[model samples]
Target chain A: MSTTVDRPLRADARRNREKVLDAARGAFAETGLHAQIEDIARRAGVGVGTVYRHFPTKDALVAALAEAHFAHLADIVEAGARREGDAWEVFAATILDSAAPTAGDAALCEIIAGHPQAIEAAALGQERLKAATGALMGAAQRAGQMRDDATVQDVQAIMCGFGQVAAAQRAGAQMDWQRYLTIALDGLRAR
Target chain B: MSTTVDRPLRADARRNREKVLDAARGAFAETGLHAQIEDIARRAGVGVGTVYRHFPTKDALVAALAEAHFAHLADIVEAGARREGDAWEVFAATILDSAAPTAGDAALCEIIAGHPQAIEAAALGQERLKAATGALMGAAQRAGQMRDDATVQDVQAIMCGFGQVAAAQRAGAQMDWQRYLTIALDGLRAR
Candidate 1:
């Protein structure tokens, strides 16, 4: 029988892992998936070999980074769910905040899109995200804070539109997602 | 001074003009400015010489077609402004309907983008479009059906987003622009 190694990473190893993720996040946000892994390692102040030792492959590194970002977003959604006040307000607040890409999520998307395996992993993450969003939407509807006629699909569309606008803005193009959002929402309000 | 042509075109000339415009609209839509004028004349069941007789240059043809289309859109916008009841509802209806390419506007865009001189003429048409859209939006705000905070810029963004979704639909891709529009508008409503 082969024995499995169960040893923990050393302190230096852990620090290197954190640094690599941070650097990768920044690089992806600035230039997209084409950003080089060696550059990320250099920015992280780690050797290329050290980054490989820690992450195995660029895709693996990106998938791990993406997981962490989604976990952070899930935390925000959970926090909003637990907030006191109308459930609709909580859901709306969370949705609005999440509309813009954080440096991490954008990088994760750029990184993962190149790797088929990472794309599958991201799909799983997206499913988990949908469930979290659905919960918030349901609570709002139940509390009469939001119009019952509105569906989870409606919320997802807003998120997508907002993300597209934010992406354009990141590219130094000005596009407003807010005012149209206001006018559309007025149409959806319960009479 | 040359007398403005006092006589209307004879029956055969009028028939040729209509045939040419229809063919030009379709050819422009399919192939933009690269669509050969000879091909357009063939499609119109006329000679290349006849096409030249009716339209002195590609810009002349494109400008005439664009002028007619923009004038029609302007009429719609004006009608919406004069609507007595809910301005918001009418405004939304008009935008949603017009956002999709009619068989005509797509041809105009294709021709304008295909030819440099036509592009300049198209710019003039766009200026007219913006003026009409601004007037309609102003009316909606004055009636308090739309949020006072909404700007013409925001409306333009919504139109752009809708256009993207419409283009996707045209290519047989499904995207829920309608749902997105609803959620976005709900978010914008004065709550």
Candidate 2:
């Protein structure tokens, strides 16, 4: 009887947490770092106290989002690595897929660019991303499909740069990030 | 006698204006957009009234600085165009030179990334830069030295993206922008 009662309660708590995160992601995507906790709680169909129970603060919410983003990126990299294809094709596709702008991208960019401390909170996810990307980079380099001089760090910087360019475009700058990505991809090709 | 007196006053005002600009540039580079006008006045060895007299507001000061940065980039592009070298070499040199990080680069990146309205104030300077870079890009493309698909706007976006990467590096991210630039340049190549 105790296990049955606790199990439902735990499931309810987990569902509430997921709802809050989903609402917060949408809010942050639209308004960026200035998105309010109250708005996110209302959107989640939860009281503000529930939001505080899960995240404690706006920074905590953002940190959780950042961790999720890193995990998503790691999954992309791992999937690309698993694909049986030309090394260069796999590497380039991974780069393009990871860097392609999405609604959630703006919030990740803001967290990376403005909230360095939040990154610390996402270290486990970041480490997973780093390991996944590093393995892919090594395979591509060993196959002579990508420049040997480029490091995993270089790829991360390029992706981060792409995020900034995309954010700027969304903010009304007239430029295409796909073109920019193409040029960068060419630059990464092995001589 | 009246003309002579007015000439000296004008000269003094111009000198004060230059000093304030120099101080503001240093301050903005070190502290970004959050730098205070009073601190800039103090660094310039002028009264707060002097800075206000010359710039009126922080936005105006930043706009002036942005215009100056654009003009400087225009000068660099024109000088590269005038050089006697392989069109590709000249184009690459110009891009690298312009994108090379400087103390003032951080402030320029902040303005370009954060203040779109200020760009309108620097339209004339931006036009000159566009013309100069366009001519260089045309020459390179015509010589079959650079990728023909790229537009001048593409080049500008890449440079702006590079600026953001450099700024982030300055903020303690361990990344080498020179390597990033090299990869981008390769992407711009005709091959």
Candidate 3:
């Protein structure tokens, strides 16, 4: 009887946590790190007190979001590596797919570019992402599909560059990333 | 006799103005737009009153710098186009050479990325830069030596992206723009 009573309560807590995280991600993506905790709580359909219980501060929430972002990126690269196909195609597809803007991507880019403290909190997830991308890059290079001179670090820098371009476009710069990616992908190919 | 006396005073004023601009460029490049005009006046070996006499305000000074930046870029592109060489080579060299960081580059990137007011103040310079680069792109594409699908705006976007990567590296991100530029150049090449 004790286990049954505790089970529903624990499940309710878990569901509420997930709702808060989802709402926070959306809020952060749209309004950036300035998104308010009260607004997030309202969006999550939870009380402000519940949000504070889950995350004592906005910084803690941002760190959580950063970890989730790295994990999502790692998952994408690892999944692409697992698929049996042309290594170049897989690599290009992975990059292009990941570059596709989701609601969370703006938040992820902000964390990577602007929040060093949040990144420190997500160190483990970043390591996982680095390892996953390194393996994929190695496989692509070995298959003689990708340029040998490029490092995994180089790829990361390029993606950061793309994120910058995307952000500028969103700010009304009147340029698109599709052609930019095409040029970058072409440059990445082996001579 | 009065004209002769006025000539020397005018020349002295011109020299002082140039010194202030040079000092401001270095200061702004190192420390961004927040660089104090007092410090710039000191660096230029002039008084704060002299700085105010020349430009009146920080915004006016920044606008002047922005205009100079665009004029420099325009000169580079127009000069490159006039050189007798492969159109592609000229285009690539102009892009690569401009992408190379100089003392004023950080300030240029900051102005381009962060200051809409400065850009507006330099509208005529920006228009000249656009026209110059557009002619170069058109020549390269017409020669069948550059990719036709790309636009002058695309080139501008890529440079802005490169600027973003460069800024991040300066902030201690472990990446370099040399390899990034190499890859970007490769991408811009015609197959």
Best by DockQ: 2
Candidate 1 structure quality by residue, lDDT tens digits, A102-131 = 522445433321223553556655666667
Worst 10 residues of 1 chain A by lDDT: A107-116
Give the clashing residue pairs of candidate 3, or none. Answer: none
- Residue pairs with colliding backbones in model 1 are A181-B184, A181-B188, A182-B188, A182-B189, A183-B185, A184-B185, A184-B186, A185-B185, A185-B186
Specify the poorest-scoring 10-residue window by lDDT in model 2 chain A: A1-10
Clashes of each: 9, 1, 0
Tell me the tens digit of each residue's lDDT in model 3 across B1-191.
46555434578899999999999988888877779999999999999999998998999998998888877777777787777778887888877776674323666666654356887888887787788788888888899877888777877767766776676676678877767777876787777
**Which model is ahead, 1 or 2, in terms of TM-score?**
2
- Candidate 2: tens digits of C-alpha lDDT, residues B64-177: 988888778778888887888788888888878876634246677766654687788889878987888888888999999888887888877777667677777888888677
In terms of lDDT, the best-performing candidate is 2
DockQ of each: 0.20, 0.56, 0.48
Judged by lDDT relative to the true structure, which candidate is superior, 2 or 3? 2
Per-residue lDDT of candidate 3, residues A16-74 (tens digit): 99999999989988877778999999999999999988888889999998877777777
State the TM-score of candidate 2 restricted to chain B: 0.87
Off by over 4 Å in 2: A1-16, A38-50, A101-104, B1-16, B45-50, B101-104
